[model samples]
Target: MIDTGEVRIQLRKGGHLKLERALGARVTSVRGTAWITAERNAGDVVILPGDSFIVPCDKLVLVGPLSGTVTLELQGARDAGSGALTHRRGPIAKLWALV
Candidate 1:
């Protein structure tokens, strides 16, 4: 899916952000540098301005800034040609969590 705009984030050096699968975020560095790590994925990724990294939907991810301050643009995944959030039906609690 594609997004026309993006969510912005700012992080200080050595600071981290916890991510959930609901976003399916595609993070693009706007300034400084950032390090990305996924719980179910091996290895770490570093991105500078103009670089982007995709976050998988089935795992947790941590994003940390490597520079004094880093700016990022986050684009969330959604159904193609649709604006609503959609996922497979699961337990009631999990389904309500999306709300």
Candidate 2:
């Protein structure tokens, strides 16, 4: 969970960060390219420096460096379970379980 202002994070090569229930947050790449994948999303997103992506919903999202080290900035991200829907199981998860 991240506060509203802004938060910066650095990801080493081959390392990743998992963001859960990060709805409406904006991710911006500040350094190297960043690879972003979200649960239920068919395509992955790559953001270069100065680019940004807004989280669509409260789901599991993965962020990492495309190569080498990467720096990212997050804005308007809130704590997990803090959104309107606080249940641990989201609607989709409750409807169907994968594998």
Candidate 3:
């Protein structure tokens, strides 16, 4: 489920998600690998697990899994309350803690 402040999405191989006017939003790869390409950007970015990329401008952005399934966390600029960031546990993190 997507909260008000952030969104978590899982994409299968060959599937993609599009975000429009997502300026300054931070996209983090929680699992697997994904590729990010933004409109007006010169190049595409590949993010592995635990990697994050900040959208540089308000443009159309596409994110897709490079292989297998990919889980992503997107936090918008307004999501940062009082300029402080909060950490949330992903499934992998939770599983790791139980191990």
**RMSD to truth, every model:** 8.0, 9.4, 9.0
lDDT of 1 by residue, 1-99 (tens): 544345676778766666655345588999989988888687999999999988765566777788698897766645443322221221122222232
Clash pairs (backbone) in predicted model 3 = none
Better of 1 and 2 by TM-score: 2
Model 3 over residues 21-44: C-alpha lDDT tens digits?
556778899999999998989999
Q: For residue 50, what is the lDDT in candidate 1?
A: 92
Q: Which residue pairs in candidate 2 have backbone atoms (N, alpha carbon, C) closer than 3 angstroms, thus clashing?
A: none
How many clashing residue pairs appear in each of the predictions shown?
0, 0, 0
- Cα lDDT of candidate 1 equals 0.65
User: Model 1 Cα RMSD, Å?
Assistant: 8.0
What is candidate 2's CA lDDT for residue 60?
A: 84
Q: What does candidate 2 score in Cα RMSD to the true structure?
A: 9.4
- Rank by lDDT, highest first: 2, 3, 1
Model 2 misplacement above 4 A: 1-3, 77-99
TM-score on alpha carbons, each prediction:
0.68, 0.75, 0.72
As a TM-score, model 2 comes out at 0.75
Instruction: State the lDDT of candidate 2 residue by residue for 1-99, as single tens digits.
Output: 544466677778877767667678788999999999999998999999999999886788888899999898877745534543111222322111121
Model 3: runs farther than 4 Å from truth?
Answer: 1-3, 78-99
**lDDT of each structure?**
0.65, 0.72, 0.70
Best by TM-score: 2
